[model samples]
Target: MTDQPAIELNNGVRIPQLGFGTFQVDSDETQRIVETALEAGYRHIDTAAGYYNEDGVGAALKASGLARDDVFLTTKLRNGDQGHDSALAAFEASRKALDVDVVDLYLIHWPTPTRWLAPETWRAFEKLLADGAVRAIGVSNFLPHHLGRLLETAGVTPAVNQFEIHPTHQQPAVQDASRAAGIAVEAYAPIGKGEDLSEEAVEAIAQAHDVSPAQVVIRWHLQQGRIVIPKSATPERIRSNIDVFGFELTTGQLDALTGLERANRLFPNPDEFEASQFRD
Candidate 1:
């Protein structure tokens, strides 16, 4: 625990560089997976209302026997909950679902450009921060333009911007902008959803380091100062994902992985994905 690295946020909050992601994890199995991650020494957990597993996450946390403050819990407001009032309501609902009094980080799940209510949603986030309901606030799947709009109207700059980032789709431009703004960039699907792990370049790097392809990718993210949340339900894979602090990637190996970037986005582009108009 002492050797693990943490990234400091603009607000001075410290987050563990390596986190466990609960995206696509079934609600029924989320508790067991989360427990496994905790047992494996993962203190940060990322989930979302859209994932519909907050309760499961909460159950695992309660059962872990660790103090509430020992863990960093993050969840997001769903797309439908994008307006000021609804966003506020949704935040409370998420808190309730998680069975926690407060969340360490809260985020706008997606920038619903079609609904065009991100600004309103941001206002709700501001209130949450002001009221101490959330210690940090951020956005996910937000583009540069979306972040610009948020900065222009937000009283507090987002502490983090989470998006799909992997060896195949390293968002350099987005990462640059986030760095310039002092906003931490968090990588979701950092292993390329198990697609690029077998690529020649990643495999070669893994061979050089005598580690798994996933370890090489995660190490790449840590070396670049980006926060990574890789998801896995298997006990061995979950344990393996966080075993990256033992080794470091050389500059050449890091550059090779960087060169593998091809802008191959796995998730929908927020700019083009028409956000569902249903407001809950």
Candidate 2:
């Protein structure tokens, strides 16, 4: 049995605190890799339309033989597909691609604020939740200001706010804002995509715990009460990623990891980023 705990969202949906992510996992390899993650005891899987691997994720889910409700699946609307009508259409396409009648959580992939489309797109997500097409709705890469703007007229408070969070990018303001708004925080790139795993503090914690640095980081996220999704296609790492429930970090170690934060962000600022930059 999986030892991962679940955190309740504002909408009362409980999501696994630790999950498997399929960000850069190629579409061709997603099926086998995702299946491996499931076999390794990951009950939650994070995917997105822009990842271009929903079909493969769907195939793995079908092949896993687990009941549909046994897994918590999350997918996002592509940044290129914003606005009310396009967002609705994109959700339909993603639903078909994932072969699911209703996804557990659906998210706006990015605010793309330059397009001024997040509020419009969020309206579409609200409709999906109301229609029972999705169990929960949230946004990714959104900061407090973005959320503040959306909340002014939003019919529903977002259940979660997912963003790039790691030891090097703690985002205290965002975390505080989300907590004030009663939105759960979900951390993507929880280990900074293997960037800071070798750092002195992380390694020191790893050594003390007799675990890998990645595990220490994952545990750190958990200790902070944020949901974390760490991705890996390799079988060994995939299994080891889910083994974090066995250890707990000391308060001093947790503080050390917190001290590693330099507010370093690896992605474009949502307020300034445009979806067109990703196009050929």
Candidate 3:
């Protein structure tokens, strides 16, 4: 119950402007951490099947005693499960793990061009959307070329394109392509892995606002109208991460952060990522 603004997706579903992420959260500790996030006013949560913590997220939601409609939940398909039937089955597994009848947003975890199975996997995603299993469907880690190829056979344009976006690694081309197609842009690792928070530009802005560098970076994403998800295992950091609505950044500060971009992409190339990340 916070004053977070909601962004409407291409399909009319609204999502929180900021969210808590469970990327590296261990399943053994996810429930406690997520419950902490919930208590800190994070109404949006992002998880993935590959993260192996949906059950914990579901446990946290149930433990919080919040109504189903009170939160927006998102999860992603595992890279290995990239086919019509496999993807559909994977969704069922994720749904059951999360204990949700309908997922707010379901994303194909990666483009996995090497697999040559994304188009087929997207068919399953369309089926899920049509069948009302998910409120919206999208993809993550996709670049412009990936989106272009998927668009060739996709009947439903993705509602969102989430990727690693930070002060240092802004993907302008992908952002342009996604927005051009009416898809919302979501940022992961918004504060960057390590070096971003310590940068002079970010630190100077933080000093001006009297906030943490992470908060300043998060604010930069929010002020730009982009959805941001920042993850933390610490309670103080988790609460502090969402307390970014108290102040704003000036145009000069925002431009300074934008000027920090050096194409420092931190993730693997989607095209070269093998479809089967893990084997049975």
Worst 10 residues of 1 by lDDT: 271-280
Query: What's model 1's TM-score?
Result: 0.97
**Clash count of each predicted structure:** 0, 0, 0
The global C-alpha lDDT for each of the candidates, from Candidate 1 onward, is: 0.90, 0.91, 0.93
State which candidate, 1 or 3, has the greater TM-score. Answer: 3
Q: Give candidate 2 misplaced runs (Cα > 4 Å).
A: 276-279
Per-model TM-score on C-alpha atoms:
0.97, 0.97, 0.98
Which pairs clash inside model 3?
none
Candidate 2 per-residue C-alpha lDDT over 114-221 given as tens digits, one digit per residue, 9 for 90 to 100: 666878888898999999999999988898999999898789999989999999998999999988999999999899979989899999889988999999999999
lDDT of 3 at 140: 96
TM-score of 2: 0.97
Worst 10 residues of 2 by lDDT: 271-280
Clashing pairs in 2: none
